[model samples]
Target: MNTQLVESVIQLIRSLSPEEQAILQEKLFFDFAYPSTPDLITLALRGGSFEFLNDEPDLYSLTDGEPIPCP
Candidate 1:
């Protein structure tokens, strides 16, 4: 990913509270097993390797590749 984009993502994550950060990290790792959750937006912004489907407004779905599944 572009360095600028990565920086932007890091900045956005930093803006959230600690609890919100934890929730975002968890959702990024377990999107399929768990139902969609509040942190989906933040996860998408980070741009995992998987291809994402833009189902909801300003939201996306993992269409291809496995989600990174990390915290």
Candidate 2:
């Protein structure tokens, strides 16, 4: 982490009005709490390998919503 950049950010935040600071705080909290899908995908890819659990092996009739008899 860059100490200078962090200090700069802190200074900028300190300069904001109370309302603006609160809004910024809320935004930061939300950003950390619920990350975007792309962020999640990147994290998952970095953590480990990804593989499909099932490759759609069911019959085409099953996928077509046909009322097939169940064995």
Candidate 3:
């Protein structure tokens, strides 16, 4: 990797506003969480590791919680 390019990216991130930085943080988290390839959830389901969950009874109904009114 080019050292100058790495430093440029750091400078760009430092220039972001607080809100923009927060958004960037979330984007980084989500990229790590799901990844670019098939996600972990899909892999787990296909591997049948969590198939036992199908036997669990539903704990909550659709009407269980009060809905927040979105702006």
Winning model by lDDT: 3
Question: For each candidate, what TM-score against the reference?
Answer: 0.40, 0.42, 0.47
Q: Report the Cα lDDT for residue 51, model 2.
A: 40
lDDT, candidate 3, residue 29? 85
Candidate 3: list runs displaced more than 4 Å: 34-71
The model with the greatest TM-score is 3
**Which portions of model 1 show Cα errors greater than 4 Å?**
33-71
Task: Give lDDT tens digits, candidate 2, residues 2-58.
Answer: 999999999999999999999998888877798799998998887655544256465
- For candidate 2, list the clashing residue pairs, or say none: none
Model 3 misses residue 64 by how many Å? 23
lDDT (Cα, tens digit) per residue for candidate 3, span 1-71: 79999999999999999999999999888767755555766788798988999999999899898888999
Cα lDDT over the full model 3: 0.88
Give the better candidate number (1 or 3) by lDDT: 3
Error of 2 at 3 (Å): 0.8
**54: Cα error in model 1, Å:** 41
Model 3 TM-score, 2 decimals: 0.47
Report the lDDT tens digits of candidate 1 across residue range 1-71. 59999999999999999999999987888666764665676676676634544443644467855788788
